[model samples]
Target: MADLVSERASEAKEITRRTALERGAGVAAVGAASALAAALSSSSAAAAVPGAKAQDTSSHSRGTTLPTVVAGVRIPDSQLTRAVTEFARKVSSESLFNHVMRTYLYGSLMFDRRGIRYDREFAFVAAVLHDLGLVKAYQTPNERFEVDGADAARNFLRGRHMPAERVEVVWDAIALHTNVGIASRKRPEIGMVSAGSGLDLTGNGLQQIPADALTEILAAFPRAGFTQDALDTILSLCRTKPMSVLMHPFAEVGRRHLSDFQVPTVEDLLLAAPFEE
Candidate 1:
């Protein structure tokens, strides 16, 4: 445990607060989304999840334009997209905000490559706000970050008078983006967002992605120390709210950092249950 703490301390030192702030600063202001779009048609924007490779060898294409449209659907400047980005950017750290952006771009590209049709607008909203729970504004002890983000997203959509069905779709996408196998089988939009997140964090399905398209997205958004930034968020939550870690992947962070943390396995749950006499 001491060794783990020391190692984490060393890693944190390597990624200084100033360095993380610089990455956030690098994201062009919201108005530039359209300009970014015109640039690559144009590109993208994340995070570390456990068991996922933190390294990405792809070079980022630096661009001032943030794409308003991607994978043949309008994003960024759309009503829901705009609301989510504006709210998210205000509350989320730069690294997290950028992660959401990359989620949209990577998810959109994945769907396009697979001949799958999706709701681009919903994807954009879901991707941008997927991590809203990480931001202080939405943090709560009662629910996991995913649930907080989903609730916040649904409210945002409802406020805009979006159809309830569409709101539900976006809500599901945000809630399920981290659910692995289950998400990929839900609505097409939900599956894409989840799959896109996997691609960015772990390079899970990288082979299916065209090299050129990936390059363009990275060029615009840049990883910018995303892995470290995201890890920080996960670890912080684990220390502050250990109960929330039970079912989510972030539980790994809790198990590693919290001394009393004990993740219950399937057998443990079964033995503890109040079944049969």
Candidate 2:
């Protein structure tokens, strides 16, 4: 028992050390991307016409303009939205980044179809940052991936000086994004984040989107083997933090992928509770 405990402790320390190293390496890249995003935001604001709707024109590289409309859904181009996009692009893997963009677009189309009103910027930010926890830099050793991503998004928005209430909403949207039943019952923005991400992953609402629109969205953001990549990412977290996956769907991923994965079931915990009866 002592040996087992020591081994697990060593594993935890190794995960933490590796995560710190990865984050340190990523810091420089994130800083450069953020600086450029800030400059673009400034330039766009300066070039804007009074009372004109903001257009999606931010670019990561010279001579490239991000599309303003994808499948008839207008992408938000506010300063904050631009920053969120740039940050997600820099931090997320290509497959994960594409998944989030599709999540936002799919959710937006669903909102339009259902005649549901939602804040585009809020929903977009939530969707883009929803999977941040799955990234090495954002992953935490103890928290569920969803909560880790939620906390990261909250910190990012708070750094940008977003309003408190709005920040909370985004946090909820990201944190509860995986809990379809609960999230779909919350605010329209929150529900859209869940609905959108779920649709992208599971295609539960694929029929809601038109065939042409689906084709256009897929063309704009290719899946790039999102299913396999996403699964592998989740399994990575499971291997590192088996305890964190307990009571979550990620536990199943660990069970299927990790031969040595072992987490106590709810019934086990109940029976072991401090009760003499």
Best by lDDT: 2
TM-score of each: 0.70, 0.77
Model 1 Cα shift for residue 261 (angstroms): 2.4
lDDT values for all models: 0.58, 0.66
For candidate 1, write residues 14-57 as lDDT tens digits: 55564333212222222111111111100121122112222222
In model 2, where is the ten-residue run with the lowest total lDDT?
A: 32-41
- lDDT by residue (tens digit), candidate 2, 1-277: 3444444444444556544332222222211111010111111111121222333332334224459999999988889988887777655555666788888999899999999998888888888877766655565677766677777788778878899999899877877777666677899998887788877777778899999999999998888666666566666666887766554565666777788887644444444444598
Checking candidate 2 for backbone clashes, the offending pairs are none
Model 1 TM-score (2 dp): 0.70
